[model samples]
Target: MLGLSAFLESGRGDKLSSPVKQFIQNLLKANMEGPYGSEWPAEEKVKRREMVAPEARYVFVRIASLGEFLTTSEREKTAASCVEERGPIVGFVHFRFVIEEELPVLYVYELQLEPRVQGKGLGKFLMQLIELIACKNHMGAVVLTVQKANSAAMNFYLYKMRYVTSTISPSRVDPLIGIEKSYEILCKTFSNEAKAILEEPLELVHSV
Candidate 1:
């Protein structure tokens, strides 16, 4: 993946400052509220709780002026200067490493981007970095939830990124229930067991 050249900065959720936290909330609301619709209130509550989890991890994309690069490497290069130099937080991915159906996985909880940055290839770059992280940690797979209503995001993951709707996704397990659900679980597996458990449909898993 042609990445950020170290422009992407990562940190723990617990270390996020008040201003950074506020940026996340505003960005999430701006980027996701529409797809969630009336479920936004409940989903927002869930998001708030998840964002502060002690183990949660983040990849923050800071504001780089039109022709300038913003990061510790390019800026003053001190911990404090990195924070003070980068203009603002414009995008971020919140994720965690956790056990899912007995398999260790990297779960992406949120991927939010500012509207102005939407078509600039940053989203795909971030996902590639996330997948690389999963592989480095020997995670069996990288998993995420995508709203059915968010067609752009759905396309980006399912088609562009080659992620599949996981077998555990509501629709895959039970079509009837899936019809009523708003989101789908998607995964990219690195092992056969994970492929069977997460990528194969429930019926196929039962037969095998």
Candidate 2:
């Protein structure tokens, strides 16, 4: 069942509620520890907390009785009390609309699903919904960063979703220079303006 209608949107003003933060932390630990633990354990902990901070917007998947999804907006709401008795949250997507390199974009910070829900097309469904949101808001593109060690995510974004490596991605800018970073930037452009801006050579754009 699970259609696009079963998602709720919430905005965290200056801090994440305890319950929401805990949910994110648990998901992050389950999803990222394997890829990031060996190299920078402490850093991963810091990053996980930072990712779910006040500034991020969230979309939570809710299951309905009839097997269809429901969509709700809590833009004016605050605190975890709103979610106290909303049943189990199957998964969530954290993102923000921001301007990157002067180009407007929808940047996805995290897309974590319960282990039992993985590989059921829910991830792809959520991403498609995000793209729709971006387009409606006039964002030129959608972008996200993936850890190099997370092969599954990399494959999902690149091969399955057809996202391309951003021209500004460290590796794309300069392979040798980018080796120091452990992540790759990926993007999907929606307009010619976005393509021109994001696909331009970084060196050329920087010089201009």
Candidate 3:
């Protein structure tokens, strides 16, 4: 069975081959069509390729064949060798390390899974892996933006994963004022310093 350890990581400035880029594009188009496409125009959706090309780094989960797995050292020999030959990518998570509200965080730009792979606990495992990466890198939190129209994602993050709407997030600051936004920012904090920044009421923080 394919496991989390089998997934391959891609980082900044890594030139993804055409097949890999296509794999990512297909997943993004399929997953974001419902809410994001509705909110943004068709042209904007098409333009996402250009936008996503530069900033995104990825963890790619590809299909593994029975009794054909290679050791991690062997897999690193080639860029795409770790991925299955002529097989569809199972899923990918795009993220970057950045500073938000003056705190360092691992910011998840996108997470997409094929319909066939949904509900197999892979998503949760990927999230746990990212959180571990964040802690190891001394990041204060893990953060992501979710479209308000995507109730499934909202429920998954807020209810199942215990992520909270960040204190400085527009919606958390003032729902009425922030309702103009199409997305909500959420975070899972790992440090007391980060929790203090993200969990306190904005008014209280300002008053102090």
Candidate 4:
């Protein structure tokens, strides 16, 4: 991995260049195509539209190569510049701040890393950072959707990150309906109200 120098930046989806959009589409296909199988073609049609929605924000992770001869100051500048223009992009997180069950939350639409970086704690670092942002911004919780077919991802969020399945998730609201669905909604709550509404296994009922 050449001791990856990963730098991140946040911006709206519309601001992404064509190359970066292609990178995201390719990465998503590589990671999810197998899990989605026959449904992949249809799913990708929807993703293409969602990935560029004006309201969505993104965090891009780009890799910068460092030369040993470069001074510390030079390396830092090179990295920051490469992140904006020349570096290879390795991963991204697409998110939005929205109302979930009447409480404001940061909804993670996608969090993807190249296969080479999968087991290196980068995913955890990103989620922790996202959760911190949500807390700092006074959001109630951090929410995300995970595919049931991707058991590795489900386990990662549930056990490693300690995110509970939200009450609004289909399974928690109604098992019959949830059984036919392919994904689960997960959340990490920050307040008593959020905890009760999102963490508990309750049906889909709005609070007064």
Superposed model 4: Cα runs more than 4 Å off: 65-85, 201-208
Which ten residues in a row are the worst by lDDT in model 2?
Answer: 73-82
Per-residue lDDT, model 2, residue 125, is: 86
Query: 39-154, model 1: which lDDT tens digit per residue?
Result: 99999989988998889999988755523434546444323322546655667899999999999999999998766556678898899999999999999999999999999999
lDDT of 1 at 188: 97
Model 4 clash pairs are: none
List, residue by residue over 1-208, the lDDT tens digit for candidate 2: 2322245656563466667667777777778888775766786667676665667778876543213222233211221213555545657888988999899899998888765457768899889989999999999999999999999999999998889889879987888988988899999999998987777645676796
Instruction: List where candidate 3 sits over 4 angstroms from the true fold.
Output: 1-6, 11-14, 42-55, 65-87, 201-208
Q: Which residue pairs of candidate 2 clash?
A: 5-69, 5-70, 5-71, 6-69, 6-70
Alpha-carbon TM-score of each model against the true structure: 0.86, 0.79, 0.78, 0.84
How well does candidate 1 match the true structure, expressed as C-alpha RMSD?
Answer: 5.3
Which candidate number maximizes TM-score?
A: 1
lDDT of 4 by residue, 125-196 (tens): 899999998999999999999999999999999999999888889997888999999999999999999998
Lowest-lDDT window of 10 residues in candidate 3?
73-82
* Local distance difference test values of all predictions, in order: 0.83, 0.75, 0.73, 0.83
Better by TM-score, candidate 2 or 1: 1
